[model samples]
Target: MTPTETTTDHPPRAGAKEWIALAVLSLPAMLVMMDLTVLHLAVPHLSAELAPTSSQLLWITDIYGFLIAGFLITMGSLGDRIGRRRLLLAGAAAFGVASVLAAYATSAEMLIAARALMGIAGATLMPSTLSLIRNMFHDDRQRTTAISLWMMSFMVGGSVGPLVGGALLEVFWWGSVFLVGVPVMLLLLVVGPLLLPEYRDPRSGRLDLASALLLLAAVLPVIYGIKKLASDGFGWLLIASVVIGAVFAVLFVRRQRSLDDPLIDMELFRNRAFGATLGIMTAATFAMMGLNLFVMQYLQLVHGLSPFRAGLWVLPMTGAMMVGMVLVPVLVTRIRPGYLIAAGMAVSAAGIAVITQVGGSGGFDLLITGTCIMAVGFTPAAALGTDLVISAAPPERAGAASAVSETSNEFGGALGLAILGSVGTAVYRAAMDTDLPTQLAPEAAGVARDTLAGAVAVAGELPAGAGATLIQLARAAFTDGLQATAAVSAIIALAGAVLAAVLLRRVRAGEDVEPNSDDTAAGQVTPNVVAT
Candidate 1:
């Protein structure tokens, strides 16, 4: 290649500086992901210290995800306009400040507000990281390797959040969980400018404020609705919120279609590879997310494991996922991408079937084993599906494509939590009703029947014999709920595997070109991936 020629056509490989930048990017990816689940393990401790009402407690735990999902698209496009590196650095600064505020929060309200701010900052971080990968790595094969490592970082952070938080909480205050991000962010702020190159779209238009608000209006209400359904079950208010949000979503798309520079070029969805890959990603996430929520509770309440132990137990699954991600990128050079993804999901479906065997009676061995298998099965889809999504997009529109991929996963998580969480809660309530100790007063029985956690708390105040009996039955009831949920997840995963095989059989990696296609039409590339 000529000295003045860029690597858009021919190969221009990443050097040592680019490799160092990937390491730098991993810091924020790991921290953001760790922050997402770290709060879950801190809930009991923080509730005691802050004395938040049930409602306030829910906000503290949930606000970060809600805001991050809501803002991803806007921030993604913003990066293309203003520059990815600039947006990343700005988000890191905001994230560091928010972390400190959250750590020192004196009141529940203060913490909730701080978490919300952090969510906004998190939105800015994700797309910029992925989009920068698209810009930095010009070669197809090298890009895949980069993305796998990046994806692994996020998975590792999520998998170990409890372990890290548990070890921290064992000695430090609950606020210590929030403090983990401070030093990481400070390091990124210092080293990022030195190693990371800036990339921006030369033809990008000024951001449309009205369209941005419309997109937020479209997303936030639906997320609020889903969370409402998860926490309180379906209601008229919840139904209305979802319907209204759908209307706004339609309006947002219509606005995009009219703009000279749309927030997201609608043509991206027309490519079969892009659509199919995103579909697989969404289904896989939807299946796993609900399972994760209930399993965490099961390990803590039923098995009575400390936070660290529970986190350690979850690592086999996460580690398998990490291994699978790296493994598939290498395998893709030999096997067809579609076949690999479809086969992976099929294996996960079988694992989900095995997970249904998890009962109240010493079933943890099966639970851990099945989930590890399931996680390994999921690796191909996570790694290659994202590869297709980014690779299928046109270079200028990579930011929008990255946002869409992340948004699909977020929406999948919300959908899983809302539908399956409600189902599991219903089953637990019904099953526990027959199992609660008869000698308990009506008030105590009511609390006991509400949830396994509530039952455990109530048992603590009972006589020794009654407490032991209540604990035993509550665990059994919760286990029954988990079995039903696992069955449903299995069905979802199987259906995804079949759909993927059909839709993407002809779609191979490193072979897309779109000019009439408005978004980035991917040809081939490498990886940088995350949610947190």
Candidate 2:
């Protein structure tokens, strides 16, 4: 990694070539995320076809995220060592191959294995694309603008996944949803090398394999345990995952501190902007992911809508996210990013507060309006947080910073779904009597509580009078649970926003310099100052 290799420049500013590069790179990036949510929409269908037990269904859905969370930091470091562009090409090819495996998977076991492999490939795409963008756009306004587009693509992919999946299911088999990634990946495999500049750290050394393994040991079990608890409630495996997570967490931290070439710069935690920005990223994702589950459930179960219809109803949040992403960079020049973050979280809290008050019988208008407002609030928080994290770290370490930011995203979403989703399940189940009709099987009752869609399916199969009564009870109970969860999530979002505001105050005032200047070797410049 010579200086020439490390300093390969991109197109000037947000020119057509640069934006085209961003768009092309973001295509595969979007596909990876779309894979997550697209499968989510197909889960019921997948469950039926695969005949997976509830636990297996949970694994099929959650293992990708767990794998992604565990390996993000390690892969990010590897990209910086091996070259981000080369890794992106390799990852895209592997992702395409994994998609074929996922599409053709015969059993829940095979799908789970394929999904985990997909996670490995998907993990390589995120940090590399984000860090590449950071390297490509050096000017402040251009960089911020590129981040806005990048953020928009992420939110839009998440929002559109179910809609697209639902449409695909109507025309093709459930497996066709997995096939969506093939062409996009091939496009990346071709165009990415030409347009995307190659970069690697000259000073970076062999990846700390031991620390990487330690991180995997620490993070994966915890996420796996949470998924188990969400689906089946707590048990011995859950307990073991928690205990193992604690042990490996301590060990991983110690290893990182001692390593000559650490997987993550543990000391990045001391940077106020970087740390708080990570919190903003985490909290925003938590609220967004948690709300997505309840809102989809609310539309489908309480409102008696189909998956496609429910996706349509929640479309405004997706639209708002895109609109917000476009607006944030413009706002950053006028208002301090700290204020924008605080305001964004505050707005999201307001939306969540409105969602809490929603009744089982509320109209779609309320759902759409609430989610849109929340998205408007959340969009700025996400884009700005990414900006701050990239700005705060050295250029060579950009991949690692991006990885940490993404880890926060993956783990935060998993934690949100697990913890808050479990709360909803518990509340719903508790409200139902233990002595459900002798005719109603335990498995049937369990299905009703898993998701609103499942509840509606259960309702259709029951006797009319019994079905109506049980449906009303289930809907009310789930709404009650949502109210509780939304309130707590709103509080968390507000608290995170406040903390981000305070932490960013020093940096926002431009009263101090960023801590990591080693980026000088990687073409980074000081504020209003040149690199030495």
Candidate 3:
């Protein structure tokens, strides 16, 4: 069918029932992000209770993300074959059960196992929610609005996670953090079937086991390596892990091309709108995540603000992001998404440039202003970029397409943390090595060089004047690292802006662009456009 015909015969607009179902769908989406953020706050409490060894503690923290990244593609494809609602409900049930297991776990190993299960279950939720949004909100404008709201929920979840976790830890055990998801999931289980519509591709082929395995092999090692690199710095084992994942990824792609019915539709990437939008989203996420790492640490370690106070200071940025997300649907009606997205990236680059001027002793005003600007600037690409990704795919393959979008985000965040973090760490170490107090013992000096946290701890053990001097030098070195990282991020944001402008210039607002005749000849579904 032609693009015109597709628009002419577009699916009926969603009703109040569909809108209510969106609220129901959003519960799990918020809960999934909450799970990611809340765990970090609980780490100290859980460690005291579980008394886990160093490796076990690492597993407890890292395994959840690792498993989620590994299973996302598989779960997304599974949802396409089974039913999105069905998969969503099943995942909710498993997530709830895992939460319970994690909450009452008797040992470190058990908690790790529970978290791993939660990861796999969590993977099922993200793509299912997005794909369902695609299937439910058939109207272009409605879909964009729904996606914006959906993205907003994630920001809400992430922003409140620390506050909620901190509040719970004050009066309750560490396990209380895990219990937060139980009520949310239980609500999803009860109302989800009654409210949410079921969607699946009737023509989808059976799930390919080998491809699933290959995806796992490809994603797990790379994510693991990235996490290791961020935490432990560069190492031969980590490099090998990344190389192994690359090999498996190549094999996975080749196998997909040969299959009559591949696990994911590779041709979707051939659509320039889809491909370019995905790239922009990933790059934007990379810059945002990398800078966030330094900003948080700077608030606590350099400025010596309490965690709660630091979190309160961050509210403005979150508010700025929420405002931007709310406005994009309205703006997209008047502006070409390509230009709008490019402008957003350009603004983000400008914000990162502001961050580059932040100093060691005091720059609280600049830090908040820059991050809020960055948040506002980045929101357009995140909201509209996601809409384009799903809209550009055939509805039947929306699940797989959503998975690919999310997977790119995971890779982007990990790469940002790893590469930028390594650069910052190297810079800090180099500066600290030359600036350390000569009277300090070698072991103490080495500890101070390792991290800002270490420097703080070691400084406390020194004479009062020396301690103050050491802290001053450490903060200065860390600030240098932050400045360097921000510079790199600014460059990346600008590059993304240029790429979006060049690649997506033809993607006008309020109109759908279909795949060319070549895509039709290749048996690819025509890409849908969001109407004004």
Candidate 4:
């Protein structure tokens, strides 16, 4: 190719208008993440008001995530067929309407339906925002920077979700948490059209309806099974759900290979950088989310802190993540992504090691320090791994690639929660089984052996000396569980670091792997590699 032809092939660097649009795009990204955790603190209030049964309450809490994970690929592919900006605006409007319905819902069933609608709407926002970034910031360096800022918004939203929810719940009713998204979605709908550019694959074929249904069938059951395993433990029903989901997934993949216009481009996974980055992202998220489950409970139950207070302690870690986000974009300009990602994982592993030293009491300082360190270490993987995934695909297929990236994260998080939670529960039960006071009745002993919360409740009915001994043993046993979970997390993070370093060593700074000949012929943009 001639120099001018090469120059013309790449889009120009993003200007100020693109940067402003990036700010607008971040609103929905933050809102979607916030929605994931915002309802945790509101569960008690909502249950009391709505008087939902146990199963209904679980549905009200979990249905949002289930639908989001299930619909991501479909919505992402749909964006490529339709216009990304068009889908985003429509989803935003839907999200706003759903939020209002949820906030004013009188019945648990209504709230569950509203949350489900919000989830489906929420799925469109993430991939659309990411794909838009891919198109808007064509310059490699600028795109990396934009992605860092975008990922930072998600971290901030996750960390603050509880804090925001707690604040709202303290003043308003449980429904107020749902209302928070209404204004944000309203703003997105009003301004999205004015600022964001709409882009879609001109050569893309019609979206197949069968593939869409197969995808939902495949994803929903698998995710539901994982969530159930985490909450209810091993069961024949959960195993069957997972098996059925796997069967549908196989059908979905086979159908994709036969279709002229597949919902997902299987070629994207054939790229080394794309596949490796996805694996590394999954591993990192697995460790982070698993350990996070214990840390939150540890702060509230062991440390005798309120929900709001626990959220406050989590802020330092979030602050560390924000600082890392700012730095990773600059560091990537000088260092290869492999080295940066590897180094970050190593640091996160060290943080997990520190957390293993935490005891049942007076562990506030240690837990905070360890989590902050972990956040700093993992930040590079969060920011750069996402950039690599999006960059691996041609711009036309960026939406599908973004959805794949998100699905890996969701799957990793669910897996982590299930496996690590099971391990911790097993350890806790073993310890409690031997330590329970012999004088306790069978019913009380069974309850105490089941969970830390149960032990605390059971202890209140005992005599002073017996209650004291039971409380002490229960806290110690829970601490043992926490230590074991952190140990597993440390090992996972360490392994991920090694994997990234080895697999991604050839990928240079500010550039993705070169597309193959087929990709080039199919109009993939060659990444501009920066000199080492």
Candidate 5:
């Protein structure tokens, strides 16, 4: 089929300018996703400057994602009603303003609020860039190539975020890192109007207020619960959060079924390609997020590296991702995507297996070797999974579908941290039992563990023998926990690869082709595939 024969939701004649618009819109995605990991590197500085309470520090890093998870569907659907280009610009402006709020904040609470607002704004950018790219690219080869680069920029941001944040922290304060997004947003805002075409769903209905509320009600508590699990462990609060999230989730699904224009088209799951691809993406994200969190902590605390040095050590992973992004587009022409994902997963499993052996005694060399191998092994799956999500959805529903993809990304990260983090904490506490100063009041250990500095301080006040024993226990416990987590993640990655091969076996090359929207102008119509 010709380019014009497959174009949908826009003029069939998109050129290089349209591609530029797609790339520029992706900038905000990079900024938003980058912020997710960048804050870990900045935590030490933020704590020193703001003296945020333990809960407040977690909020500072997590609120952006929390709000994004809560509002993604509503905002994505809204973009389909209003012009996507309009919403992208509006979201960019909001993001810029939020960045300003975050940068100038005098208190931790203020910064947390700003990040939440930025999440709401950031949600708008992700779906718009992806759906817009689907609108712009018609030829299968060109679309594959475009989606590859688009996925690259977003993943690259994630990989490079800690490095960039660390570099900025070396010279400037923690707040300065928030300002890094400003220039990129400006470039998007400036170029968006000149090159991007406007698009909206003419048939979109009124925003369903009840469904939106139910969505926020559902996602927020679950994410909160998971985050709590990471910090604490299994408890009443965690159980309640899970229960409440489930209740809201039930309501949200019911509302979607009854409503004329649902926030999510429930029927989209019937597409095998779309459904299985999302699963792969979600599972991949779970492994990546868990690894990133533990490795950074291990690098800084146990390895005795500065935040800047820790970030620099993550470069191999980032470099591997860029290489994978560049290579996958070319490889897709000859090999099936399912096989690509499987091969990648096998390699990733091997890499994570290596991490299982790392201990407190391991140096940066060990960290680099493990993270680099895992990154190379996993990059192909991440890049391919995203491409599949975009290619599987119809044009009109692309925004909603992309929102689902990002939600999986956000939720996977949140849950991975919660579950794996809890695992780590439990092991740490377990191994340190009596060595954990029962002598120094309960309040002291609680306060000390809350801050790295406080933890170090408490070590000083203890008796020499007790303090040395305590440090030894803490290190041993953490290493054991991390190794266990890595083993589980490797198993999960391997299982996911097997499942993907089974689910995607029928997806032949060029299955993404669709009848062009211009076919309507030419008085031809295509048959629709019914949901099974």
Candidate 6:
């Protein structure tokens, strides 16, 4: 069919019922995002009860994100062949069951197994939610709004995680954090069938078992390697895992090229808009998450706020982001998305510039102001960039397309946390070694060099005079490291903004650009497969 003919056949815009369903579908996405960070607050409690070994302690906290990131593409494609709603409902069921298992686990191994299962189920939720949004909102304008709201849900979940985890811990055991998923997933299970429309690719072939395994092989090892590098500096085994992942990734792509019905829609990337927008989203996330890691610690260790209070301070930044996300869809009706994205990213870079000036206990205003500004600026890039990615793809392949966007996001976040965090840690460790008090023992000095938290812990093991002196020194060194990291993050954001402006210049808002002109637009609208 011609582009005009295809566009004419599209479904009507969604109504109030569809809007309610969108709200309902957002629950799983929120829950999963919250699950990623909530465990940090529960670690002490969980360790005290489960008595996990040092390595097992790391696994208990990290394995969920690792598996979720690895399986996103696989689960997204699985949703396409089997059915989006069906896959979502099944995942909700599994998530609820696993949450209960995790809450009551008797041993470290049991909790790890439960968390691993939760991760697999969590993987199914994100792509299905994004793809469903793709299928639900037919008009470009309405779809942009829906996508922004969906993205905001994730931020809301993240913003609330520590507060909610802290609250639950006061009255309940460590397992209460795990149980938070149960009620949310149970609600999804009950409401999903009635509200969610089913979507699957009729032409999608049998499950590509070998390719799926290869995808897992490609993602899991590399992420594990990165995590190890972040936590333990570097090792030969960790380096080997990254190399293995690179080999498997090449094999996976070659396998996809050979298949009649490949797991991912490789042609989607042929659209310049699709490729560029994904890159922008990835880079934007990397800058934000990388810098925010240090920002979080600065609020706690440098400024001496409690963990829960630190979370409270973060609320303004995320709140500003949610506000900006809601506004971008409306703004894009008049402004070209390319320009909007470029401008927003530049503003975020400006925020990073502000962050670089932060001092040890002297620039709290600058810190909050800069970060909230960054949140406001970066929010538009995230929302509009996602709109462009979904807009660029064929409707039938929404599940796979959404997966690519989501997978890039996860990869960018992981890369940011691993790399930028390591940089800050390295600086802190070196600075602390020089700042150690003369009264400190050799083993105590070594322990204090690892982190600000370790410094505090080791100080508690010392005489009162030495302990106070060590804390003053460690906090100062950590603050210096944070400022340096902020400078690097600012550079990353600025460089990325310049790239976005150049690459996305031809793309415009409101979606009627010529499809054949690759540089001018994302893609032509196709006939809708189902009504919302």
Per-residue lDDT of 162-196 in model 5, one digit per residue for the tens?
A: 78887888899888888988888888889888887
* Model 5 whole-model lDDT (C-alpha atoms): 0.76
Q: What ranking of all candidate models by lDDT puts the best one first? A: 3, 4, 1, 6, 2, 5
Q: For residues 1-532, could you state the per-residue lDDT of candidate 6 as single tens digits?
A: 2122146545468999779999998898899989988999999998999999998988899999988988888898888888889899999999999999999999999999999999999999998988888887887788899999998899999999999999999999999998998888888888888888887766678879999999999999999988887788789978999999999999999998899988886766767678878888888888899899999998988888999999999999999998898889889888778788888988998988898888787778999999999999998778988888877877667777888898888888888888888888888888887767766677878889888998989988878888888888898888878877877777777777787788777788645334346465534757445432
State the C-alpha lDDT per candidate: 0.86, 0.79, 0.88, 0.87, 0.76, 0.85
Task: Per model, state how many residue pairs clash.
Answer: 15, 0, 1, 0, 0, 0
Each prediction's RMSD to truth: 3.7, 4.3, 3.5, 4.0, 5.3, 2.6
Q: After superposition, which runs of candidate 5 have C-alpha atoms over 4 Å from their true positions?
A: 1-15, 40-58, 107-109, 434-457, 462-469, 512-532
- Clash-forming residue pairs, model 4: none
| lDDT (C-alpha) at residue 380 in model 3 | 87
lDDT of 3 at 138: 76
Segments of candidate 4 deviating more than 4 angstroms: 1-11, 514-532
Please identify model 6 stretches exceeding 4 Å from their true place: 1-6, 9-11, 510-518, 527-532
Better of 2 and 4 by TM-score: 4
Candidate 2 accuracy as TM-score = 0.89
Ten contiguous residues with the weakest lDDT in model 2: 523-532
